[model samples]
Target: MTNETEVDVIDPVAQIESYTKKDFQLTRLPYDFLYGLRNNKFQYSQMQVVMADKASKEGVKSFKQLYKDYLATYHSDEQMLAVNYTEFDGQPFQLACGSYICHDDIALLNSNGIVEEICNHPVLPCVRLVNIDDNTEKLIIKYRKGYKWREITVDKEILASASKITSLAKYGIAVNSENAKGLVKYLTDIEDLNYNEIEEKNSVSRLGWINNHGFSPYVDGLVFDGEENFRTLFNSVKIKGQIENWIEIIKPIRAEKNICSRIMLAASFASVLVNPCDCLPFFVHLWGGTEAGKTVALMLATSVWADPTMGAYIRTFNSTAVAQELTASFVNSLPLVYDELQILKDKKSFDDMIYKLCEGIGRDRGAKNGGVQKIATWKNCILTSGEFPISSEKSGGGAVNRIIEIDCKDKKIFTNPSELVSEIKQNYGCAGAIFVKWLQQGDNIETVKHLRKDFYKKLVADSDVTDKQAMSASLILTADKLINEIFFNDDILLSVSEMQSILTTRASVDQNRRCYEFINDFVAVNYNKFNPEKDGYNGEIYGTVIEDRIYFIKSKFDAVLQENGFNAKAFLSWAVENKVAFTAEGRSSLTKRICGKVCRCVCVLSVEETAEDQLLNNEDLPFD
Candidate 1:
């Protein structure tokens, strides 16, 4: 053991140098570190020795000294940054920087901790204006160079490590190694000194209750987590003129010969009714010729709740289905209004969208960081306008219950659409809140349920629409009844007789039946694609025609069905059940000679005759 009183000194500089091989000055080393060098107990490593020696000898106690003298050593005193820009546009812009710099952005840089440079792999300023709530990581960051405070709430993972902290340069914050160490120290210091808990919730925008309370976006306790996209949406849902003004102008239109105006208005309120009535989403697709003014009807519907601008609440279908699903989740209880369904990516996908949108839950998606993304859910009616029917013969019968296709035929919906648009643009978003207020009132929900049930019964008894269709239509009718009674003094009641046109049933939505017809038509036109029995035909052989049966090459048949957007396995199974197809005795498909080649095939009755012919020849009828 070394002497307790005597100094057991070894070379301190040599110990640090041997451990790290870095030269460090000895101006600021404590005497204790030199004494502990004998037992390898030097607490200050070589890196710390170098950092302590090099740390600004001019100790910056206040933010002012640290910002101007120390921070400027790394970057120019006159730091120019981009000013006054939201991460996105068309929303209320609140810059997070304590003050936005109108001219060139001189970042006191770290003066207010708003326009900061954070430390990362390269030790650069990755984040700025680090606003935190208490000890929690509910961070709001400042961007732009102007005096305005446009703040965006960021995730805490931004502060995790070198790579994560570096990604904050996306907000136009200048990042370099200047004053990085001092700024990093300042961030750690402020975290302990300042502790104010701000109320930031991930509240989604909707028509009904916000934050589990009644429907007031403003005066609500929770500050939305800086998703100003929803701000753009909610800002448009402002109350302009009086509710009486809206009713005065729209009541006459509701009474017009065209049932479209009434249906559109009812469907607008029907979105909020979906949750209250406890039903899945349904579509009210208004379709017609180009001159039928379906867009005008859509505008009227959108104006009932928000700004009637074309791209505002009423958007085009010129986007991906993923975008639409996110939008649906965003506007949970509001009308998911889409204009020009003709511009959708494809009709087949749009046909599938009805079932998807009605399901009220988004598909589980994988995140880039090898994690699951949040699945979105919503219950609301979808309003669509297009030149042709949204759902066609290719659609399944179940989709029929999800969609109520309105045919405007050749009739023009409005005499003066331009004038109506002008009036609505000024006086909108007045009635949606009023309608919701009545629904949210104490004990009024039972009335809505009873009224919906009564409407459902009447619709089923009177119209040929299916049970699901009748149930969906009843919600619309219930909304229409309630809104008329509450808002318009029951003056603009939508007639059940007029609305029944939407529920009027005619042809089948059965995809299997349509596939059968499509196959018959396809075979007639594509006979040259088939092989002949003579073995002298010149072309690609899709199948072999033998007597009354066509033996299709299995691969070619599946490819054809897939190309035309039909499930091959599903169609073949349906065909077998209906006796339109013939399978091998012990197998699902035929192993037969097709086009003079022994291969797997799907045997189907020719367009001219069916295999039901064999059942009649059996002579096994009990009645006989």
Candidate 2:
């Protein structure tokens, strides 16, 4: 009996093999026909709705119109026929001729069979379809910079890939997999094929990709050597029944297609943080109630990374070295997990440092010199939690867009986390193997999207939510990359309130403030970084944190009251006047109110003493 449900599995080649040698004729369909059919299937029909939405956006319309306008302007330039550009092969090619207003008898430009070549291919039909506009004449001629134009239908896919590739390439990661998309499509077409086998094979291949792109291992203390030993450690366990359960947790029942999830697992395996430059300052947030597995999710993510031994460093209410170390480590990779950040007293300076490290320009000189001599301005992802969003007092500049958030709501610990960890390591082959499979599956992450969206919907429906800091920074970054890859052209409105609400719910107000005071003390000890440009000025930098009124750090303000100098009490008074409230701890009651008020005394400015005056009137006072 012939089973119609059976999927035809073939080698990498796009050939349809029979179930049995006697099942069908040896050569009924031509190879080229099968190959083209596989490439141009309607399997992505579900994706078309999204594609049409993107094409209908206002910015997309503007882009198309702009190109049309540019082309129309060229039509009037009689002197020019068309513009010319070189192909990838470096051959001179003429673009639409332009107006040679200054000088030129004939249009002295080389014209290849480019125009005819373009009118007949995917670049014209499928790729260029995205350039569709209400005005057809203006739309067709606007995009004139290519030997082969992409088809609109397929162009959407290619453009999405191109944009992602370009963004990554800027950071020096080039993907030369010409048929990578086609290959993925073909492989996925096989039904009933063991997905695990495919995932493992692909995971290994993705690891090699990291090394190929010049990303060295041990970024931020995480190491990924692509060692066979680690691979064995990952594949030792089994996910047999758990797969179906996990799939159920992902809402919508059906997984959405996206590229971010693929990269997450793959990059995690390679121990390479996928920093998509196009989405600068990506924001990832974990929000939900307590015991929701937010921390566990972060741990899982970190463990899967190439190396988790030094993947993070936890700081306390008063730790200077930890802050410096985190700032310096961000340059290469690894997330700076600021645990229990809500317990500190000072928040201003601490938040300022975090903001800059997350989004501001690269660290100051010597920032990357991770040793004692290093400066503090390197980039990094910060993970923390409290009851509210980190405020400006605790935030240096602003929350970087690169920050990603995840929700760990309702996550229970019925299963032993250690056991799960062991199982993952032994059976799944760890990050290197898992991620390789994800990458081999190509950049499709509809599954993750559906999961996230379902979670969001559930939260909207529920009222008893807790643990707002359930999401991890990595989760947000992964989401952003996926959104960009899947809905690059879609005009979706994002709510700032949603972002702020989630962040505020996680940060601690007092602990965040104390972080500021610590920075102030460090600067006081090392004053060269903030010396005033004046003489006879005695002002000490005051660091204080407000209570639940605000979360996170504010800024470093100067206290002008000069007492026993460095008076903690008097400084607190000044803070009150400026609306900054904080308590001084571990100081004498008298000093507590005027802490470190004077950093430099007026007498520090010694004008050159006149020799004659000093000789006649100067007398050394004997010390008691």
Candidate 3:
């Protein structure tokens, strides 16, 4: 039935023998041949003859009838043949079906072995099934297009192969009609089940999911798991000097016994979660003095998310605009930690940008025209420093309502953080594990509310005006959350009590003055009285009314007099020299009269006023 191959004499024999060895056994057919089999109609004479002969032997009227009979014969019982298929590279053998075959067995094979690899079936083809060690229950399947034999123990797919085989036979091509249907169905079923499992496994993979810069989709060279214990997460301490003091800084905050304080903290966290993106964009203002371990606490906060590189830390004085631009690329990660935010100029422009970047939708102007383009909505968190709670430009809106404050200054008052940071750095991984566990234990909003309530209960006695203000905001934000938690109640909309509580508290006059220093400067340089076209007061000119000899000094007197060529210095000198009811205190009062009289003189005798005087006195202009 097969031809024997000579080891050396015949040139054709040597070539054929080498080709038949292991490498070319299943691969002798060219790639184009397989391609043709898959894409072209299967109507070749060779397949028709085989089907005709099989049909005649079985006394069937058609090829379809013969295939049905073949399948019926092997429907209940089937045997799996064990074979080692190998590929040869010059002389070295690559494992094929599971091992090496002698040269003698290679020569006896006809038309090569294993036709499935070269077949074009809609269903995934199998090359060989190996027992794979003592585990005969799990078979190693070498699929047609796959790189290696996969181990499988499921039989649901194997049991459903009968129908698929019958369908393939009607079209042509050679098939072991006896077992093709059962084999094809089993393979298909297994593939579907296997894919579903893979998807589920990958869904819960949290590695590199949380970070400081934002949320990274992928991270390298890091081990992540929420279950790791504390002892295993840290490293050995180099106990000495400032390094010894770092751990001391973190102790009190870490060992907080009051549940209310943590609830407030959780409520702060929930404010962000109310609209948290995968990136978690939110800002937390942690204001305090030095040695408070504010920096160390920030580091601990990041540990909960795992990986410091995921977050970026910048001092308050840095250009916030540039900071926003740089972090834009990584917004999908986690929170952007703005350290020492107090250094930024307390102006509306700078603060507003930060405000919008935190809770408002970030937007930019289009390059060609000034078209408004909204940036991708990100959930990045914000952390900054300030002595007092900042007010939002648009108060009472949900955006500003989400911000929560923590009084870290009080807790870290006497504590030293030098040693705590050293310990935390060494055991960063351990800290992260603990933080994750803490988050999973309760509803985050409720947890934060408790913290805030307990904190106020403790400080109700000596709380300063600043603390009271921040507490009120926290309470309002909490009440909003509680309203949602308890189901929307009609009481939320009926009263001005909530609004009055937040609006009534005014900052101290000294504090207000300091707070608006930047705004006042902006106003002074650019303020103006109403200009119909310009929509506000024209700040450039001091308002002046000119009529006859008296002038109404609505604004800058010096500039107004000088523009009229009145020899403002000479007039002041004359008024003083003549003692014409004039005094240093009377200058403004007299100036107003001088401006008003000049205005009236121009109205009654327009020809008497010079061109410069007409231009200088806008009060007489018809447009005014």
Q: Which has the greatest TM-score?
A: 1
Q: Cα RMSD (Å) between model 2 and the true structure?
A: 24.3
Q: State TM-scores per candidate.
A: 0.68, 0.29, 0.36
Q: Which candidate, 1 or 3, has the higher lDDT?
A: 1
Sorted by TM-score (best first), the order is: 1, 3, 2
Query: After superposition on all CA atoms, what RMSD does each candidate show versus the true structure?
Result: 13.7, 24.3, 19.8
- Off-target runs (Cα >4 Å) in candidate 3 are 1-249, 253-294, 300-304, 307-335, 340-348, 364-381, 386-415, 429-504, 507-624
| Tens digits of lDDT, candidate 2, 531-605 | 432355466423222222211112222232221123334434443433333333432111221133432211111
Where in model 1 is the C-alpha error above 4 Å? 1-152, 156-167, 172-211, 216-222, 368-370, 397-401, 461-464, 490-500, 504-507, 526-556, 590-624
Lowest summed lDDT across 10 adjacent residues in model 2 is found at 118-127
- The better-scoring model by TM-score among 1 and 2 is 1
What lDDT does model 1 reach?
0.63
Please, what are the lDDT tens digits per residue for candidate 1 over residues 1-624? 223233335454443333321222222122223323323323323323333333323331221223223323433323312221111112232222222221122233444434443432111112223222122344555434344435455555554443454455566444434643433343333333233322234332333444346554432443444345666766676677878888887877876846777887888898887887788888999999997889999999988888999777777888777878888887888889888987875677866888888888999999877799868888888999999888876677777668988888968999888889899888888898777777777888788999999988887774566777877788888888877787776466766666566673533455665676677667778787764554567777777777778777888888887878678888878878777788988776788775557888888877543432333332321111
Q: State the local distance difference test value for candidate 3.
A: 0.34
Q: Rate the local accuracy (lDDT) of all candidates.
A: 0.63, 0.30, 0.34
Measured with C-alpha atoms, the lDDT of residue 113 in candidate 1 is 33
Residue 60's lDDT within candidate 2 is 38
Best model per lDDT = 1
Superposed Cα deviation of residue 496, candidate 3 (Å): 22
